[model samples]
Target chain A: MIALDDTDRAILRELTHDAGQGAGALGRVVGLSQPATWRRIKRLTEAGVIAGKRLDLDLEALGLGVTVFLGVKLALRGRTALGDVERALAAIPEVQTVEHVLGLYDYRLRVVARDIADFERILRRRIMTLPGVGEVEANVLLSEERLGGPIG
Target chain B: MLDDIDRRILRNLQGDPDLASADLATRVGTSSAVAWRRVQRMKDAGVIRATRADINWSALGYSVEVSLRITLEKTAANAFDEVMAERARSPRCWKSRRFWAVSICV
Candidate 1:
């Protein structure tokens, strides 16, 4: 657990806002010199707070237009079964995010596809065949309203 | 709308955003000017949004990630708006979707 000061937080915010910005530009926003800012960023990266940079892709532009959440329940619940399911999920590229939740569902999976027909094909072909898989409730996403931005 | 060269450039950038235009040009087998222009065009077209750093929240002592599935009251005129407005004020409300799932760490 790393304790971040205000300056550290500001630097993180600025970097996550746009890492492509030069050290000088980031320093100007975060109230540090270029060298200082670079050093802080290096330290943060080394400390594992800053994992790496990512190129956020436009999914629709990439032919992934439909998004759905699957509330999954497994017939057999155990460590091995859970591990197997997770490994299977990792193998499927269309599955974007997976969360093991504490609720009526065992897992919540976010998946993207070209459309409903494509989604149906993936669901029938891949998702359902996983070991110990039982019931899955599909929730189609209509509109997404992000309240707060990504964590810095 | 991206050509083969643009896709190649994007693939390289997706791997490492820190690559300079010269390095990118070398890797993509294009002139530095062309590499820079293509990147600028993608940015301008919003195909490439903000290039941002990835933070490991788990490493920062955020061990618990929660997913909340909520069903809102559709009868109220401004129910969703009010809820979102209230949530937008809190930093802890990292991500909220209007449709179904919400992932947060407490």
Candidate 2:
């Protein structure tokens, strides 16, 4: 594991807001020279603390106005078929998030669309088409107090 | 450069991004300059990443966030690589963190 000092923690907090900010500015805020800050950032990335950067977007702007979770059941049990189904699900545009789940269901998904009509379209046109799915149940999310980032 | 005062600053600042530098210093039991310096140092170290922005996505008329979890048939050829690629291009997922052959959507 990569050991981080207090200074490192501070750097993480700042970068979480805007990774695009310049190194010089970051160093200026933290009392390190630009070069030193650069080195530290490099180290953090290498250590997997920084992970990766993403371009966050608004769902409404993209015409995806609804969000829901899905629990999926598969009718077929073959590993090869399972793999094919996975690929098929991934190809669908409406799928936002997908995971192998625990509990009553075998898998879950987060999906989005402009409205219920649109969602139904995706369900019929795309989701249900996956080869091995036995059943898929969807639940619209209510509220999200938090998404990601540092949640202490 | 971060001392005890710096830790105090972090605790206060992370909890409240709007806390002014003066108020932040006061909370940390340090002079404004010391607080500023320590905060600067901590920032450089990449610990405290950024000032929090309370973005109301819904206020901007964004839809609720969708969450997804998917499983692949374990025996399919190159299925992992295929799903992984879709995970990369997915426009709807706000957060997609990879796990052991499984991905978490947020």
Candidate 3:
């Protein structure tokens, strides 16, 4: 088992805010050499704390014009529905994230599209195809005062 | 090659990665040379990918957030490939955060 100390967490937080920072820059903040920082990052990746480096891009640049959240409810007998649900959603370009959640809702989706009609086509055709999916509710995100703001 | 001073340096950087090294060293109570070397070494390793990020929404002229859930059957590998491809086509799919843990006594 691997236990991350306070120092390790500090490094992670720094990376989260700005993943583009180089190890040399990170070392100055985290107190390691470029090599040592590299090693620690590799270890973190192996340990699952650090998944992978990603670039936060401009959404509109890719032609996704609207953002919305969808709450999906499925029948209790839908354990078998997982297969159809995943495959169908995977084909929608506007859908960015899929969350399996607990509560009255079974799943939540973050979607981006040019407009509501685009969302309707995907929802009616792909998402509703699941055998157990019963209720699908959507809340369009009008303005995000804080996008990707730090949690905790 | 890290002591108490080095840890202090790292802490400062974590809060604000945009600070200059010489300025950062001054705040960490160390000389510029030591700070520069430490930073230089960290860069040689992949511990840090970069330090500059321009995140100005006003300049970009757009806003977005997208979330979706995908349940897959068959080979988990094939499903994952499809999901990744979907993510790649959409710019809003960036910043994927996930948590998974497994424990075993070997």
DockQ of each: 0.42, 0.04, 0.04
Model 3: CA > 4 A from native = A129-131, A143-152, B1-106
Model 2: residues with Cα > 4 Å off, grouped in runs: A29-31, A78-80, A147-151, B1-106
Which digits, one per residue and each the tens of the lDDT, describe model 3 over residues B25-73? 8998888898888766655643343553333222223344334434455
Which portions of model 1 show Cα errors greater than 4 Å? A145-152, B3-12, B19-37, B100-106
Quote the lDDT for A18 in model 1: 79
Cα lDDT of all candidates, in order?
A: 0.80, 0.64, 0.62
Q: How does residue A100 of candidate 2 score in lDDT?
A: 72
**Least lDDT summed over 10 consecutive residues: which range in candidate 1 chain A?**
A143-152
lDDT tens per residue, model 2, A1-152: 56667777667756766665767998998889999999988887766666455433445543567786777887665553666776777778678667775566677877888897987788877877666777677776544432232221
Pick by TM-score: which candidate is best?
1
**Ranking of all predicted structures according to DockQ, beginning with the best and ending with the worst:** 1, 3, 2
For model 1, how does the per-residue alpha-carbon lDDT over A1-152 read when each residue is reduced to its tens digit? Answer: 77888888888877776788888988999888999999988888888998899887776776778899888877776744687788898789789888888788788889999998999899888888777777788888877753323343
Per-residue alpha-carbon lDDT of candidate 3 for residues A47-98, written as tens digits (9 for 90 to 100):
6655454434344543466677777776554465676676666567667778
Docking level for model 3: incorrect
